[model samples]
Target chain A: MFFHIILERNMQLHPRHFGARLREKLVSKLIKDVEGTCSGRHGFVVAIMGIEHVGKGLIRDGTGFVTFPVKYKCVVFRPFKGEILEAVVTMVNKMGFFAEAGPVQIFVSNHLIPDDMEFQSADTPNYTTSDGSVKIQKDTEVRLKIIGTRVDATEIFCIGTIKDDFLGVISDPSAAV
Target chain B: MSGEEEENAAELKLGEDFVKAKCLMNGEVSLILDRRLEQLQQLSEDPLNQMPQVFEKSLQYVKRFSRYNNPDAVRQVREILSRHQLAEFELVVLGNLCPETVEEAIAMVPSLKDKGRGLDDEAIEKMLTDLALIKSSSSSGHLLKKLGFGLASL
Candidate 1:
């Protein structure tokens, strides 16, 4: 899920960038520094929506650079256990398949797939139902339930399952073609 | 991250931080990101190289999955769903998936089936109908554009 929330950060600015457009410099620098970064606590910071506050600059005794405490609102994506998500399949293998829901990567192991759908190893590897009516391959969109999540400083990985009722391939790019 | 359990817990255990934060639907994110892209293009000649990986992936994901593309339709969809008094997470999930039946909706969002919740099957069915109505109307609008009738009509 995507969230719009305010987060605080301490930004250091060089003496050379302390001219007429100080706020502009700070905003741009904040975007460059903060966007795409992930933290275990808050998940991935996708974009900086707006700056809520910039506290008084505190300068060190020796260095001429100024440190400013900036509070800004941003959009973040995070996945939680038991949360249902729709993700696009990126790869398929014998063990399982990897699908991505925005920045979060989820793995649905062979045990998580329904029993009827058997993995077929061919030129185009995929998991197909007995009747071949339902197929999961590259670019297939699936609705899955996250059973567990591992959050690291820079990334989050999830173990998802499509074995539950109403959780399976939602769209097949191949069928559309 | 600490907060009231009632306020923070969506049927699913979204952590305290996520529950407190305002949730955005795929359609809303797509709109916000599209505007940001336009601004970035105006700012520099080679902005794509400067784009963050997260932003790039999210933009593509939302654009591909967002059910309501137009701002008016997005607003209407929100208004219709908001009337049902759903959790922000549930509302967005329903909006994103656009399930066809009450059983499917309840299945997609199991919280709706939980006891003590006032949302009954009839209400769920009504909400699905309203959502489907908007979806069909918007899709047909796109169909017209694809058929070249939209440009001629304009």
Candidate 2:
């Protein structure tokens, strides 16, 4: 899921960048520092939409650096338990397949896949149904429910399942064309 | 930690922080990214090349999954879904998936069927129908544009 929420950060600026483009420097620095970083509480920060506020700079006596509190609105992608997500399959193996829904990595174990589908080992690995009407392989889009999530300081890993109704292959790159 | 509560979509238990946060539909995310991309293009000589990996992947995901491409259609989807008195999370899920049947919608986000929510099968059907109409109208308009371009090229 994606959220547009306001977040606050204290930015440190070197005294050399204190001139006319101070605001520009701060905004660019914030983008460089914040975007792509993940926190346990906020998930992944995809982009900095806009800067809400920049507090007065407080100079540090030792290093000639200044700290300014910055508030910004950003788009974050956080997968929650029981939230349905559409993800692209990236790999397939005997144990399970690894899929990516943006920054989050999900593993849908073989057991969690509907029992009818069997894994086919080949040059292009995939899980296919008996009749072969349905297939899950690299690049296939699937809608799966996140059964669990592990949040690290810089990453999030999810355990997903497609065993439930309305959850399974959404689109196949091979078949679509 | 108690933070890892078992929140189920069936009852719309989306944890504490998430329950109040503003949820963005796929289309809205795409729109916001598109505008940001344009801003980057205007500001720098080479823009996309410097984009963060997260931004690039998110841009691709949202652009591919967004059901409605036009701003007007995006706004209309929110407007139409909001009328059903859906929570932000539910609204975005319904908008993103565009489920064809009430059953599918309920299966996808079961909170819509919670007894206390007071939504019935018929009302859910009506909502799905309205969403489908928006999708069809927008897609047909897209098809017409493609046809016009083809004709002009010939």
Return the top candidate by DockQ.
2
- For model 2, the superposed segments whose C-alpha errors exceed 4 Å read A172-177, B6-10, B140-154
TM-score of each: 0.89, 0.90
TM-score of chain B as predicted in candidate 2: 0.86
| lDDT scores in order | 0.82, 0.85
The lowest-lDDT stretch of 10 consecutive residues in candidate 1 chain A is A168-177
- Per-residue CA lDDT of model 1 for B28-142, tens digit only, reads 9999988888899999997767888898898888877777789988999889999998888888888887776687788778888878788889999989888877776675343
Residue lDDT tens for model 1, A66-92: 999999999998776777778999999
Cα-lDDT of candidate 1: 0.82
Question: For model 2, what is the alpha-carbon lDDT of residue B85?
Answer: 92
Q: Write the per-residue lDDT of candidate 2 for residues A1-177, one digit (tens) a residue.
A: 999988999999999999999999999999999998888778899889899899999988999899999999999998888888889999999898999988889999999999999999989999998989889999988889999888777888999999988888875322211
- CAPRI grade, predicted model 2: medium
